[model samples]
Target chain A: MLLKKRKSKEDTALFRLEENEGEIVLWSENREVSRQLSMIDLQEEDLLVLQKLRPLVKENIEKIVAQFYKNLEKESSLTKIINDNSSIDRLSQTLTIHIEEMFTGVIDQAFFDKRSKIAQVHLHIGLQPKWYMCAFQDLLLSLISLFDETIENREDYNKAIKATTKILNIEQQLVLDAYQKQHDEIR
Target chain B: MLLKKRKSKEDTALFRLEENEGEIVLWSENREVSRQLSMIDLQEEDLLVLQKLRPLVKENIEKIVAQFYKNLEKESSLTKIINDNSSIDRLSQTLTIHIEEMFTGVIDQAFFDKRSKIAQVHLHIGLQPKWYMCAFQDLLLSLISLFDETIENREDYNKAIKATTKILNIEQQLVLDAYQKQHDEIR
Candidate 1:
């Protein structure tokens, strides 16, 4: 059958991130993100809600990222992993991009792969799962507050919140699986 | 429970080969290699054979790689995809390393991902699946001949052949899945 071939391309930037002198927070406890990974049905409604939140997330990206770092930096113990202001700057940018990507509305195999890599990186840098989990929670709350303001109806706001939470939970689970996989490998 | 951490890494180099100045061969038709892919059992016997054959495949690596290239070059039309002598040399070296890697006795998810990338590259380069199938056939023969020479017992040799074939079949099936996925995506 005659079919036009699209140029196949693959970029594993996720795996390429080396042990840069950036924010590498070391927490005593790590969560196995991979083991906790389970398929959450991202229905059409969820996709719609996510897409709607994209602009709001984009607008608040800087503030959201700043606040996340602020929370992380407040704990003097955590600042040890931050390396320097330059590292925080880079990480803030990365976190912003990552958050922007989440709003793409379609999470495929590639998405999971990136999350898996992130989980591995956390393990590599001695980052605790608790911190990562808390960071995610903070991101969600930031988004939710914005979401609440963006939506007029209480019912719609609740639905959007539910959808957003489901997707984030799914992402968190996948990330944890990396920790689980790593833990298994080391054992 | 305390556990040691293992490093995680992934490289999708197979799909990274873009339109480099080289050979391009086009047959009138492309096979649905993906449709041809189905799960083939990899028995313990197969793993044993693969482990045993590892050194032999290694020993004859030069001869085997030469034969593979010779087969590819024989088709004057396919030579269009090979850029030059340097390209051929580089590809030959890569093929040798890849073949050697297969004998590592464990085909994990990472292995499948690499093979899948290779399949996608074939489609992207407009190389027909027929060539891959033929190349694999050539690889099988080269190994089988070596197997025949290395093993004194015919019965053991037959068992080894059975094992090797099973493993190769599994690899072929994975490569085919890429085609199937791409075909579905385009349609």
Candidate 2:
């Protein structure tokens, strides 16, 4: 299931040399390339753990997104942000696919770019960072609960949780890094 | 200091009538009309009280808006929402005008519609109702403090606060009413 992403930009221009994880990287100074790196944080251990947990997360993704929205609506403060039912459903489907793709354990430049785009969409709609944090917390808790239900082995479950968390942490880092850059540029 | 607002919308479209606060209001069913109303809930006593306080609120408006944004930025959650320095300055000026117009005691159809539009802008940007409430609280406290400094009579100070509060309440009501309508439609 390793889908190769298209090389988005032709690397013709001069790029600054940088070191990444004991490897030499020629980084383009272009804003897009400047913000991205060749680093994909998933390790062999994380990948193996994630591969096992992927199916469980996939099956429960719908329920997780539903519960997330339920929590959001319960807070009267956030009710105003909900669009029509159809739009919510659409966003839910998109998020489910996003989660499924995330568990693929093939992090790449496209993945980082997609995370940046998500940050941009939130910022464009004036969504504050607190809401994103709230969402991430909900998603984290939901996935952990899913694992708690299906996983039998304590040792293996612990491994799964750690791997899932590592990927989640990387996802968050990508988003915040993009957010800070855009925030600084706008300011 | 009653600055008369130019009538921006022509009453060409047919509007349904609704009674509010014992007044016969020929309200249009238009989204703008459904969201707005004739009176902004400022009573005669409140208006008279607000008239006296208007000049002072006008004088300290800049300081008030600055203090509002300053408080918003202090909260780590909201810093990401702040645009560049110049954009913040521009919005502050717009908000200052909005606050001044609010106490005009002229809460006509135009005022109601304008309040609804402000609600739309906030909701469009995914700004939660809590932030609006927080802002109103800040504005309210700032204005009351300003009145306390200038007004000698305790009774007049109390009256000023009441008048300001009544208009502020009406402003929230208009925004929330519009927000609900939009939320329902989108749902």
Candidate 3:
């Protein structure tokens, strides 16, 4: 037997697992999304793993963010660009929220929708793809290091990371398309 | 002539660059430290690059944060972790400050000091390293993708990342040491 529930967004994604099964399965538009995307089936041990890693990620994010700003300030070229509008307080707040949300995971349709909107926002601003990729790599490496202990099974951990990277790559491409379309419209 | 300056906590360790006089000049206390710690000198173009990317990063971070909290709400095992803590707001505030500072090139000694303290607090609570690392990686990836437009050269970008990563590794080790020493004392 299968259980189905619709998430609020336009995607109408469903969370599924076998009836009486310990894990949950996720489906979108009558097709199965990856199990990793489905949170319903997370076993007790899986939940424990996520719980254990959340705060460490939060803390390290704070550190990486601090460092990123410091680099921006010191670089004379980057300074003038931000001189008019940016502030340490504002940037820090933005990063904090972002990092916090990563651990918490996404559940709401509104939340996912907001992310789609943010992708549009990036297009308005003219972000380059390479820069986005570089930043992602740095952030990923730091995060992996932070969770080095809890990920006792290096192979599984690596697989999880590869999966994440793949998803992120897709997300990046989508944003890039949105950005290009916006740019063409403006031109 | 080499310009000597007092090391600021915010300053990346100095390294060797060919001087105008064609001599190798040391930028910091030690060659290795300098090599490992130097930040990219910002140029006007780089500033423009960063300016374009900043907002996207900001937007992405916020979206990620929302999703994170939503996921936490859905999970049974994680809810209690936040039961007694009103600290999420405080943490968010600190994170905002931290990210902004990264772009501004200003080093906040107080901020770093606070994070170090927070690490201790987590350690006291028995938070594992893996949790922090996972969250950190997630945030890092999100922000990186947000800033994809500003990165010019992948090689230089990767080098800078390596430098930053090394510094973070050092910082994490220090925090771990402090926590361990304190833990030992409590015992």
lDDT of 2 by residue, B22-100 (tens): 2222334454332222122235556555554567778888899888887676444344555622368678888888888
Q: Write the per-residue lDDT of candidate 2 for residues A1-187, one digit (tens) a residue.
A: 1111231234311111121122212323444322222122235556556655566777778898888777566444345555622367777888889888767656556666798898787666655454454465556657766765565443454455556655665565567557656755675
Candidate 2 chain B, run of 10 with poorest lDDT:
B12-21
Clash counts for the predictions, in order = 20, 4, 43
Candidates, DockQ: 0.01, 0.01, 0.03
Better of 2 and 3 by TM-score: 2
Off by over 4 Å in 1: A1-39, A84-86, B1-187
The numbered model that scores best in DockQ is 3
* Per-residue lDDT over B1-187 for candidate 3, one digit per residue giving the tens place of the 0 to 100 score: 1112233424432222222222212233434223223342323333233333344445555665655455445433344555555455665665665554343322235434655696777766655443333344444444433322333333323333333333333334335445545554665
Candidate 2 at B74: error in angstroms? 2.9
Mind giving the per-residue lDDT tens digits that candidate 1 earns over B99-167?
A: 987776665456667887887877676665445555665676677666655554434544555556656
Q: Which model, 1 or 3, shows the larger DockQ?
A: 3
TM-score, model 1 to reference? 0.39
Query: What docking grade applies to model 2?
Result: incorrect
- Where does model 3 exceed 4 Å of error? A1-52, A71-79, A149-156, B1-187
